[model samples]
Target: MSMGVGIGRREITGMVVGAVVLALLPMVVQDSYYRHLLIMVFIYGIVASSWDLSLGYAGIFNFGHMALFGIGLYTYGLATTLLGISPWIALLAGGVLAALAAALISLPILRLKGIYVVLVTFAFGQLVVQLIISQSDYTGGNQGLVRIPSFHIPGHNLMRDHKLGFYYIALILLCCSTVFLRLMVRSRLGLAIRALRDNEEYATSRGISISRQRLITMAGSAVFTGLAGAFYGAYFRNASTDVFGASLTTLLLSMVLLGGISTIYGSLLAALLLTIFSEMIAGLGAWRPIVIGVLIILVMLAYPGGLYGAIAAAARALRRLGRRQASP
Candidate 1:
């Protein structure tokens, strides 16, 4: 019981430290250019965290997550632009559509094991991108859509170009997303997700309804990631296949793996760290992917559990040192 309590306390401590760092970000870094980068970090942070829901928790490797994310982007944009709906309503619609899309896709694919799930979802993601390109009538085809409506929060305008407003709005979503996901991890459903991830057959034998849990996890991930997609569309004032492309999916997957798979704060830390690295190494341009790939390889070879596991190990070592010092 005390060990469990210690773990919870550690999670809270890490989250608080993260929040503090984010709050002090604008103050330490006054440049608007870098501020824009911070907003992007927060934006991608949402998608990465959402990805962790299934891939991390449910032991389900889904590579087509960006498809649901793209659906959210296109769904909200088309619904609002075509039907003349409000942005907020469109946002809700985007999330709902994303969840529905996950459900529709997961019905058949969720039954498959790890590698099969990856392949199927990857195909689905590719299909969504292709369909968007083929149907120029609705999606503007290869030309993509420009100047989609920006984010509006009651009185404030949350445009990506507007550094301060964008930061605050994104921070709210980022914090809320983290808290909500953490609670789910602590809840009954969270336990089920872990169980399903560890051993689907065993979980099913225990009457855990692995299929139902997979669908729920997929839909839940889709909803938040879809919101993230909507936000990305609004931020850039545009929506395109490239934004929801396989590249984004792969990068997000790295954030999960390189940070620590199945760990709640894993994606958040990875997103922030990678964003900062990208800024520092912008001159690498397209070769950035290669660098990221190499880094991931090195991390996996050196630390099996990624960054969080390394941190945990270090914390344990420090605790041991303190205990030894206090010994009579």
Candidate 2:
């Protein structure tokens, strides 16, 4: 059976090649600052791709996706700072808690659609922020949690290596996430998700349980998103309510759009592109955001399919030219 474009051989080969290059990056680019940015790119890539799973595939306007990330972040923060647990254990705990939160939120939004889904999810995020603030002594409220634990090695110190350990960890996490999302989207469940997204009524008539699928869709998407969140906290050694803010939400949303909806890998590409691009224009200071916003708008207007679409178009054009040349 044929799968989606995201699962094609060409795309898979590209992913593999890209992964190899990224794996070799640390050796070539030893600068800690650049490595820091790449780690962030990996983290954002995981979050954005997970968001794509729900928003792009299932067509769920889950505005609280970042909320799930925050849950993981706080879970790690509190676990390490309060409970005195290992950072490794706290990381997994974070993902688990986020997944649970996603499942719970899915129940309420199951019957809702479109903008209502957006509203409910967005409200859920705000509710989480308020809860964290109300529990200031534990969460540090507005000040957030600081001096959170970082990952430890048996012999070597993590900090001494210029973030090499964290970079590899982030890369591995992103790779796992990308593989998971792609597999899910190419599976029977993924087909049902797309079907439901296109026509809920028709999908239901075919015996696809809207509730079950929707629940899985929401929960599955949250897993890596939560992990990424936990990683963010661990990497930064802190947790902040600021994660639930609109800025991150907007940036990730732009990634999903700029990458091309329904293509899991596209979001990752967008993450890499946007994160680096945003940093490159940092000298613009006040104008940096304006430049990015304008670029995104122009790109979207010119190519509705985002980067993936533009690439596909260029590929098609090259093939056409090749064929013409061969015919002569």
Candidate 3:
């Protein structure tokens, strides 16, 4: 009990320190280029972490997670640009639409298991991309939606020129997302989701509604991911077909895998590391993807449980070694 309490305290301390560092990051790093990279990190971090809620925790093979994100992106962009809605309201609308999309998709696909779920969800992602391309006029098709809009208040709308403002926004969003996910994973609902993941039949026998739990998890995950997507569109001032691309879905999956499945914060850490690594290799031209692919493969093979699991294992080994040395 004492050891468990100590571990809890350490975790809390680490989280507090991390929050402080992230909050002050913009103040210390004024470089626009690095700031932009960090923004991407936060955005992808949220998306990846939320994706884990369903994929890792609920055991839902949701390959179309990115599709919900893309839906949010397009919805927010269209609402703000076409209908001339406020940015704040548009952001909320994006989350709502994303949740709705998740619910709608979950209705049919939730019944599926194993590879069937994966295939249907994967197809859903592709379907979204093709639909956007087919409806060129509204979606901008292959050209994509350019000059959508940037985050702005009524009077102080300097986010276009100043990256600092956007950095803070991203930071706050990431923090909120982290807290929300953490709370969710600790809640009773989270337990039910995990139980379903570990033993679906057993969980169902215990009176847990698998469909209800999974649908709720899907909606929750989609909300955060959709918000990230909306932020991506607004910050970059564009909504491209690439937002719905499989490449992004692949990248997000790699982050979750490399970070450790069911480890929410691990996904965030992995997102930050991977995003920075990608930016560093951006000058590698065509060789970037090849290098990233190799790195991911190596990490997956070497650390089957991911970086987080690997680190934890190393720590435990060290402790055991210390205990042996201290023995009389």
Top candidate on TM-score is: 3
User: What lDDT score goes with residue 245 in model 3?
Assistant: 63
Q: Could you tell which candidate, 1 or 3, scores higher by TM-score?
A: 3
Q: Considering lDDT, which of the candidate structures 2 and 3 is the better prediction for this target? A: 2
TM-score of each predicted structure versus truth: 0.86, 0.91, 0.92
For all candidates in order, the CA lDDT equals: 0.80, 0.91, 0.85
RMSD after Cα superposition, model 3: 3.4
Q: Model 2: runs farther than 4 Å from truth?
A: 1-16, 283-287, 313-328
TM-score of 3: 0.92
lDDT top scorer: 2
Mind giving the per-residue lDDT tens digits that candidate 1 earns over 72-106? 88987887677877877787787889999998878
Mark the regions of model 3 whose C-alpha exceeds 4 Å error after superposition: 1-16
Task: Give the lowest summed-lDDT range of ten residues in model 1.
Answer: 1-10
Candidate 1, which segments miss by more than 4 Å at Cα? 1-29, 153-161, 312-328
Q: What is the Cα-based lDDT of residue 9 in candidate 3?
A: 61
Per-candidate clashes, comma-separated: 1, 0, 0
A best-first ranking of the candidates according to their TM-score comes to: 3, 2, 1
